[model samples]
Target: MTSFSAAQRSRVTMLDVAERAGVSKASVSRFIGDDRALLSDAIALRIEQAIDALGYRPNQMARGLKRGRTRLIGMLVADIRNPYSIAVMHGVETACRQHGYNLVVCNTDRDDEQERQHLAALRAYNIEGLIVNTLGHHLEQLLELQREMPLVLVDRKVDALHSDLVGLDNPLAVRMALEHLEQQGYRDILLVSEVADGTSSRVERLHSFQSQVSLRKDLRGAIQETGPDLHTRLQAFLAQDGAGPKALFCANGIAALACTKALRELGCRLFEDIGLIALDDLDWYPLVGSGITALAQPTQAIGTSAFDCLLKRLRGDTSPTRSLDFAPQLLIRGSTQPL
Candidate 1:
């Protein structure tokens, strides 16, 4: 018998597995891919056993290359530190694994130069699709990438690209929160959001709050930016007299954190002196003063749906782009329910 070296013995190809399984290369490929449903139980079983016996690990990148595909997805995030972004990224990762694909994520940290760099890097790697969560400042780069591959936007709307979008229905979510606050005897409302810096979600939430509050004669609503000015603005809001109790509607998790900090510094009782209802549900929401009432955005669903949309486009679906707005589930806790 001829002796084979260690390196030679280590390489176990799908063809070797197919030969051992007494199946064709096409059959092995089918078993490896998403079309295993079309295979007979016996054939599938044989392939499985052969794979285990031969220690076969298919090179997905090589396989994709042969088919003119990369099985790689690129994601651009504005702020990777955001809790909402983390949750959504988890969902997208889970979906990609289930579909036999890989994800490459890039964080711009809300910087335009970083955005341009990340976009170029994603293209250099030959990613099959892209899910954008950045500022979309480099339109020419984005348009060029769009022509090369499928693109989907998450939580932000860039008018130039007009790609598929997945995010919350801000108007409906704002209305629901206001309605809940009104029913809880909170007549005065303050909407706290990050500064309007071309971020679509924040702008939409602010617009919705303003539009809805104007229609209700009994409710008076105002907006505040979450940052260095929040503490002073919040103090002013606390001093304002109203017909009923005052409540704060935080636009997102970042705003919630800022508002909570300011309230703590002011030595105001949490959820007792003034109610707080936030848009994105963070894990710490429960631990903070009898839990903050929240409209929990379906972050995982939004992430998974964004990937699904890109998959469709990758598979030759040239249909019109879609904008999916998932509804938030309102979770009422001790904060919103006055004792």
Candidate 2:
């Protein structure tokens, strides 16, 4: 038996795999990631055997450097703590897996500086595309990135960046909640949302509430921007009023939880003292004091569509930048009805 020298042993490459398997280096490359148009089972098996026999690992860095394509997609989220973002991520990941693409995720915590850092790092990695759930403050940066790579905005929108975007139809969803609450004979309603001026979801939901409520003289509603003070303000509102707003329309899950806490703390029984309705449905919706009425967004569809849009852009099939918005389903429950 003859053993190869150290240098000879180290010199094995994709060419060696091709030679051993009686196939082309291109076949071996395609077999590793399996991203090519198609491959016959026999040819794929040969490549796999050669790779295993030669202890050959695909040199992803070398391939990226040579081809100038990383085959990586970067996903930036404003906050990982949000369930809605997580659901969208699951959609993105599912699509990426099916298409043989790798995803790198970054949490920006809605910070502009962190967002810039993540964008720069993804660029450094030579990522092929990007999916951004942005803070809506970095339009220039996002626009610049979009110019260089295929970009898709998810769940949030940056005003100046003319790119593919997928998000919930916030105004319409809020209107659904408002209409339902009105049907329950709730005249005075209070809309509560997070205190963020630039976030597209919050802004749109607030504006929609104001516009829709203003048209009906009998329906009195006021939008309150709150963060940490959400519970305190809600408690104060409930204490001072004649019969506190007949229904509390929470803009999102966070606000919904705050409203629930405030009501419980004040010993105000839901469905007895006031009605409750929330924008995004929660896991605990059914188990709460009274099941909360909510508008549930189509998270899976949002994610799948976002990936499809990104793939279309990556393939250079850009006819026009598409902005896809999904509507929410209103779930009626005891929280919004009088006991």
TM-score: which candidate is best? 2
Per-residue accuracy of model 2 over 1-339 as CA lDDT, tens digit each: 335555655577889999999998788778776475477889988877876677666678677768877778889998899888898899999999999888899999978899888888888888888998877576776777788888888877777778888989887887788888877888878898878668887888888888999987768887776667767777766676533347888888888887788788878877677888987778998788769988998888898899899899888886988879899998888888743
How many residue pairs collide in each prediction?
Answer: 0, 0
Error of 2 at 72 (Å): 1.6
* C-alpha positional error of residue 71 in candidate 1 after TM-score superposition, expressed in Å: 0.4
Relative to the true structure, candidate 2 reaches a TM of 0.85
For candidate 1, give the lDDT of residue 74: 94
Instruction: Estimate every model's Cα lDDT from 0 to 1.
Output: 0.92, 0.82
lDDT of model number 2: 0.82
Worst 10 residues of 2 by lDDT: 1-10
